[model samples]
Target: MTPITSFFRNLEAKCCAACGQMIHEQAESYATECAPCQEQASFDAYKYYHQKR
Candidate 1:
């Protein structure tokens, strides 16, 4: 497989994008970050976009 396809295929194995945690949930296998990281990222993004200049 090409490098790009290999990278995406690895996504099916559950590697957290932020913390590098090994996730075991089938639902999160395709997700970039595990639950906590995803939550924190979402919260951070919300704050970043809404915060005062």
Candidate 2:
């Protein structure tokens, strides 16, 4: 693909829900949050659930 085509494609790319970081299609198939954000969300959920005990 041409550089300009790649640039425009990224302009409409999906971004991480938490940090608003761009998520490339090549990196993931259909990810909502980036890897780091997903990990943090998992950790937060675990901590919250454990704290209720």
Model 2 over residues 1-53: C-alpha lDDT tens digits?
57976765666668888899987665336688988899999999999999999
Error of 1 at 25 (Å): 1.3
Q: Judged by lDDT against the true structure, how good is candidate 1? A: 0.76
Where does the lowest 10-residue lDDT sum fall in candidate 2? 23-32
Q: Compute the lDDT for candidate 2.
A: 0.80
Clashing pairs in 2: none
lDDT of 1 by residue, 1-53 (tens): 56975665576456787999987686434577888998999999999989955
Query: Relative to the true structure, how large is the alpha-carbon lDDT of every model?
Result: 0.76, 0.80
Worst 10 residues of 1 by lDDT: 5-14
Clashing pairs in 1: none
